[model samples]
Target: MEPPSGSPDLVLAFANTHADGGGRPERFADVDGLRAWLRENGLDEAADDASPADVDGVRHLRDAVVTVLLGHSHDPATDDATVAAAEDDVRRVAARHPLVTSVDRDGARLAPAQPGLPGALGLVLAAMTELALTGSWSRVKACRNPPCHFAFLDRSRNTSGAYCSTACSSQVAMRAYRRRKAGSHD
Candidate 1:
């Protein structure tokens, strides 16, 4: 799963690693599970070298990326502060592990400046940085519906995708309809 050729697929996959639908536990339950994720992302060598600390670092990075993307997906007019805060968080992490520039046939790409916990963490950050630089950050988002919080790419023409799937969107819409109907009764 080398990022699926999509600009934001890696970011979405990183965020989905800890998806908590309903009352279910995290998708990656432990360090081993995190290793599985690394392997799934074609980072088998990184997974082999991962530790508990590495798992935690990946989780932190994933959360930070999700927060930033969530900010992008939400209405910036009213959520400017939230977006700013999330950008600050991303900057803080980037400051800790700066990315380096690399050029190939595909042009320049950002790579981890230095080896940090779970070597793949830097690569993940690089992918996110690329998305931000390319103005595709909003394509990656967390579902607005609570509990699901699954990350997804907004492929809609107007970029109005707020849910990971139609099921979640329908559930939220139905709930709103019920509320409106009940209110009219009053």
Candidate 2:
């Protein structure tokens, strides 16, 4: 099934696989879970070809991507060291498994330079590249609330989105309100 409307397919795939869902983490616990996610994302055709090591590799790459995206989304300016590190991590992975460019009857496309884990990561990286080129990379963000690192697209006109949903936003706001209320009474 497709993700909710307005979300890019690739971002949805990564976010759904890596993020917390309804206060519960949905990360893969084993190869079976990873395979299930692959099936869910219509990548099942390549699932059989992935080994246990490939699954581990894919998970690592996913985490790396999350780190990089979160780092960028949180702050686009003021080059923080952590953001640089996250970017370096992603660059290292991308360099390790580069994507190959090819032209077909339809148009140019990107393919993985290597099969298996690299191929899966290459597809994700290619999607990220597309977002970057289109200036939509900032739209992919991780919720600021601790332990709720759900990735979401900032569809707000001003791009000020900081949480996954109104519920999360309300939760944070309520906490702040209580803090101020308590401080005022002190």
TM-score of each: 0.81, 0.81
Q: Which 10 consecutive residues of model 1 have the lowest summed lDDT?
A: 1-10
Clashes of 1: 0
Q: Please write out the lDDT profile of model 2 over residues 116-178, one tens digit for every residue.
A: 545666677777776776788888887766556677788999988887888888887898899
| C-alpha root-mean-square deviation, each candidate | 3.2, 4.1
Measured by TM-score, how close is model 2 to the native structure? 0.81
Error of 1 at 168 (Å): 1.3
- Residues 1-186 of candidate 1 have per-residue lDDT tens digits of 132232776677778877575665564567788878877878887778777766666676677666666665673332667667767876777777666777679878777665524346667777876776777777888877766777888888898888888988888889889999999999
Clashes per model (N, Cα, C within 3 A): 0, 0
Lowest lDDT 10-mer window, candidate 2?
A: 1-10
- Residue-level error in angstroms, candidate 1, position 4: 10
